[model samples]
Target: MQFIDFKKEHFSHNKEAGHYFIQISKDEVGYGDLEVLEKQDDDTYSKARYELVDDVSKVTIKMKNPGNIRVSF
Candidate 1:
């Protein structure tokens, strides 16, 4: 799973660093969507969408089934 960590400094940082916005305005950023990968019986993954929770300082993803799940943004 790959995560964009907003916990770091903006604009200049590593891959996990946040600042994912392409353009920034005074009070808004860009619109983005997330992709989820669900683990299958063969240990492979399949594209799936469940629920994504975005808080002020934290982000969460909920899956229908409780198992190994990976998300990309």
Candidate 2:
């Protein structure tokens, strides 16, 4: 499970926009969830910050079953 965001003008809206992807087999549980927390154990990472520097127009999710999936941005 991961969120990929390309902060560039040339990447276009599709790739540039944040995308949360999770790959699972059909026979498996087929469930996933994503949450981007501001603080990581009372500390924040350099790349992942609470402040929003760039505006994300769209967020796409790719999964086999999205019924149990939740995304927090």
In order, candidate lDDTs are 0.44, 0.30
Tell me the tens digit of each residue's lDDT in model 2 across 1-73: 5433322221222245343333323223223433423223434422232112221333333422212222243
Q: RMSDs, each prediction?
A: 11.5, 12.5
Clashes, model 1: 0
lDDT of 1 by residue, 1-73 (tens): 3433221123222245331221123123223655656667897778755555565544455443344555455
Candidate 2 colliding pairs: none
Residue 72 displacement in candidate 1 (angstroms): 1.5
Error of 1 at 17 (Å): 32
Q: What is the TM-score of each candidate against the true structure?
A: 0.47, 0.22
Output the lDDT of residue 58, model 1.
Answer: 47
